[model samples]
Target: MARIRVQNLVKAWGDFRAVDDIDFETNDGEFVALLGPSGCGKSTTLRLIAGLDQATSGQIFIDDRDVTQVAAAKRNLALVFQSYALFPHLSVADNITFGLSVRGVPRAERERRLEKTASLLGVTALLGRKPSQLSGGQQQRVALGRALISEAPVCLLDEPLSNLDAKLRAEMRNEIRTLQQRLGITMVFVTHDQTEAMSMADRVILMKSGKVEQCGTPAELYENPASTFVAGFIGTPPMNLVAAAPKDGRLAVAAAASSDLVLGVRPEHIEFAGEGQEAVVAGSEYFGADTVVACRIGEQKLMVRVPGRPGLGTGAQVRLAWAPSNEHAFDARSGLRKSA
Candidate 1:
């Protein structure tokens, strides 16, 4: 296993910068995920680390060695691409052993490694089949097996499960996490999906506009977001942000109709209170186990999540309340969390 460090990394295309001076480090055997929406530089950062794309400026380190200028082939890291990048004509065993073959590894050693990787990925029976003959999940396993057979200290994955169905994606998330833990390889996974990053990564490096937004464990970003963008990006229904002022222990419109404060409360945090902020129910969605009600406080909208069906109807008058500790305050001008 190896610790990967990216210091002052920058990637640019002409005048447009894709990654801007981003810095972070992954511990040995740690799973770090780069997460953000499309065009947010997560993929660019990953490619830079893989040596697939040259950075405009910065340095990359694998363990104690400076590999900023190292060739991709010499980096000694396994990479699993988004498309699986398998040769359709080759059987699973051949695909997995291609790296070994290229390196002229002994035939017996290659076979031994192949056996272990196949067993670990549960693709022992599919060794003779081509990628085209395999299911999506099976193909993903073969792709992973290819990387595992390399026995590299670092493993990098680029949206490896995005092509799978929702159920398969969830399954693969667990499988990949388990495989990383079992192998103790330092991993860097890039994904636009927040759920995948939160569920699979030991730590998440949230990015925006080619810059580092926040880097922390999943719980840290969810419970204590550093900025309004993160507050709106991390949750299922997202946190409800309303422009309001603290009034008589409740949030309400300011008498002056001007305030730089925004109150953030997660949909799950807002509860039905008899004495709270008055709002009109604009819409409600039933999700079998829970219901999300969209409430309108004047022109602003907020969502309230409740267990089961609340039978809330449109235009119904309701008061939304939440615990003091549950409320997050942000400055409207800067869109950053306000210190209490």
Candidate 2:
């Protein structure tokens, strides 16, 4: 595969910048996900790297070769789009071989590559089926087979599993990640789904308002977010952040003079203690494996995740506490994480 580098990348239209100056690097065979909400510029950045769109002012290097101005067809990168983009009229085999055939690859070579790809993706029998005859997961596999057969060192997927059902999506996530590791191909995935990015990527690049909010391994971003936005955006049930001030040597929602600090804790970290912050249970959400209790401490709200089921119910008084190390401090005014 290839190492990818983006230096001072910027993409603008008129006065609005879709992608502000951002820089990051991906090592050979590394899987990196560009993750953000809609309109956050993740897709634009991917387009820039794939040469589908030109950067306003910056450089892109693949394997240490400058290709900021190179044509997309010359980039030697395979792209799998969100829709799978399979031709409805073409059989699976024909769809997968279209690219090879266009480049005049010999029949035997094309067949060899197709066989290997189909076997790798578990889509050998699907070759005779048309797009309409295959299930969503099967279609996805065919699309992947098509991309893999190209044998491009770099693969770019734009929400490749978004169209699948929840169960299929999970299965595909594991399958794709395993295949990616097995093939040792560098992968750049673009998706707005945090879980998809967090679970499937080796590293995550979180973006916000066209800027890189944070870039780190999944655990790094979750445990040591650089900003309040990152903390709120990276977790399941999310980290609980409440405006607070120090009171009686402990933290409270506020006092006469509110402190600039905010208290941040994960849902799973909060616990019931004999002595701690006082709160009232407002409600609860029950998932199959766990339950989340919504608590109200003063005018602020916090969520607590408890295994199985929690005894707390609406309007129930409770003492909330957590390990001192679990309490993350942040600057309320700047919305940035504070130094420990």
Candidate 3:
């Protein structure tokens, strides 16, 4: 296992800077995820670590060794691609052992490592099968088994689960997390999906415009976002940001004007307050155990995720309230939080 450190990393293509100066480090055996939307420079960062793309400037250190100029094949690191790059004619056993054979490892040692990796991945029985005969999830396990047999101290996964169905993706995520912890290999996963990053990462590196927006554990980014962009980007149904004004000591949301500030609240944070319903119900979506209520306060829209919610029709009067602790205040100019 190895700790991965990326310091002052920058990648640029001509005048277009793909990755700005970004600094992040992961402890040995820590599963850190690089998360961002498309064109946010996550993939570029991964390629830099994998030695596939040269950085414009900066360094990457694995196990305290500076490997900024190391070739991908010589880095002693494993990078699994989304394509599941399995050879067509090779059986699972052959595919897993190919790297070892190419590296000139003895047959006995290769078999031993192959057996261990197969057992770790629960793919021992599938060794005789070809890629065409296996399901997507099974094929993914074979890919993982191949990487594991390499015994690389660091593993980089580039949207490895993107090819699987939703249900299988969820199942495999936990499985991968278990395997990662059990084997104690430091892992860095790259994905645009927030749910994947939130579920699998020990810590998340949130990026935007080739820059580090925020980096923290999933709960930190979700509960105390540093900016309106982070708050809006990190949540499901996202956060409800309204143009707000300070009314006396109470915060007032406007439909007609922006009086005081822009106050943000998550959908799950807003509670339904009844015919004292000061806001209008613009829409409601039923989801068996809970409903997502879309309330309009002035000209702004705020969604509230309420469980076992009472039926409220469109134009139904309702009031919205968020706990003081759940409220996030941001600076209008910088778009950064007033306080963490």
Full candidate order by TM-score, most accurate first: 1, 2, 3
Model 2 — which ten-residue stretch has the worst lDDT? 249-258
| TM-scores for candidates 1 onward, in order | 0.97, 0.96, 0.95
C-alpha lDDT of all candidate models, in order: 0.92, 0.90, 0.88
Q: Write the per-residue lDDT of candidate 3 for residues 1-340, one digit (tens) a residue.
A: 7988999999999999999999999988999989999999998999999999999999999988999999898888998888889988999999999999999999999999999999888999999999999999999999998888898999999998999999999999999999899889999999889989998999999999999899999999998888888888887889887777666565557666454467888899888764322788998998888899888877777898999866899999877776678877776667788754
**Residue runs of model 3 more than 4 Å from their true location after superposition:** 257-260, 274-277
- Candidate 2, residues 258-311, lDDT tens digits: the string is 568888889999987898788899999999799999988777889999888877
Instruction: Specify the highest-TM-score model's number.
Output: 1
Best model per lDDT: 1
Q: Against the hidden true structure, what lDDT does model 2 obtain?
A: 0.90
Better of 2 and 3 by TM-score: 2
lDDT of 1 by residue, 27-60 (tens): 9999999999999999999999999999899999
Where is model 1 more than 4 Å wrong at Cα?
248-258
CA lDDT of 200 in candidate 1? Answer: 93
